[model samples]
Target: MLRRRLGVARTLKDFQGQIYGLNNLGTLLLQTGNNQAAAQSLVEALEIARSVNNEEAEGLTLSNLGLVEFARGNYFDAIKQYKAAIVLRRRFRDPLGEANTRNNLGDAYLAANLPEDAAIAYGLALQLARTTSDTPNQFRAFRGLFNSYTEAGNYPPAFRALNQHIALAKEEKDLFQELIWLRLSAQLYTITGDLANARSFYEQAIALARVLEDTGEEALLQNDLAQILYQ
Candidate 1:
């Protein structure tokens, strides 16, 4: 249906419609893991956006392209595209777009083993997300910070980041994510020899899992809680 609309839009010389169609198709393709097709669609959309002087559309398309490259393990290329998108987003004064691109850039940096750079990008993303009241991006930025700090062996900061993520997850009412974060917090506390916190979080996670009827997760958390108690 999207392709048909794109074809009709193209024939009618409807640049805006064509761009929208292309972006939609690209996003769908990307979500479905069709990197090559997604990239092609996004590239065409980007060209149209540029020709039409649509900075917002251009930034969005570039971000999609970055995602395609990132999924293909081309971290450098993804970073390049993300930087381009960030530039356009900043120019347009779009805080949410800027935050999203920055988060993507952080992920690319992490994938490239540049933990410090990832942390910097994530910091900016987090600030931008907060400024825009973009909770989802804020969560992503926190997750990125956690991963970057962990990679850099910054244990305390990593734990702080994880706590922030868990807090946000709870705010969003994402029980599954909250459960996962609680489990991770328990493990982190255990690793750092904070047995009291570890036991508390583990028991909390187990109780939550039991309430959710997640038998597997409850059993796992119970086992971890028992191990910590024995230690």
Candidate 2:
């Protein structure tokens, strides 16, 4: 209704709103595996954001573009987009946006196999999230750190980071985070040679993933469980 009412005007405000709507649609497309369509939508939205000189919208659209690029295995491009978004969000004093951009930066670094750089990005993201008191971002940052440390062969820090992520997830009552924490905890346990705990957590994560209808995560849990069993 609002979109229809604003259709004739099509002012800068309308363009900005359209940018937001398109960005959101792009995110949904990305999550549903339509990377090409997501990229197109994000690019269109970014153009509109630029035309309107909407810094906040531009930053968010750039972040969405970064996600699409990252999913498409264009890590360097994704990092560049994320870095630009981070600069804009920082200039605007948008801590939540900054945290999200940093998290995306961490993802790009991780994808590029630069775990130490990923760790640094995640650490900055975590600190910013804490400053904003954003529980979800805090959980994501901690999860990033956990993955970075694990890939870097820093088991102790990985385990500690995983524990921090789990604690934050519990505080937020986030079922998805709980599921991820369980899965990662299982992997960490296996790596640390805690076979019994690994098996137990893997089963728990599998059950939770089933309940959540998260087939991708369930598949990962199954694979990890198989590997642990073989070990």
Residue 186 in candidate 1 has what lDDT?
A: 90
C-alpha RMSD values across all candidates: 2.8, 3.4
Give candidate 2's error at residue 110 in angstroms: 0.7
lDDT of each: 0.91, 0.89
Clashes of each: 0, 0
Range of the 10 consecutive residues with the lowest summed lDDT in candidate 1 = 176-185
Please tell me which predicted candidate would have the highest TM-score against the true structure. Answer: 1
Candidate 2 least-lDDT 10 residues = 1-10
Candidate 2, 1-231: lDDT as tens digits: 534533533554668668877887789899999999999888988998898799888999899999999999999999999999998898889999999899999999999999999999999999999997988789888989999999999999998898888777788788999998898899888888899999999999999999999999899889989997986
How much does candidate 2 score in TM-score? 0.81
TM-score of each: 0.86, 0.81
Q: Report how far off residue 92 is in candidate 1 (Å).
A: 0.4
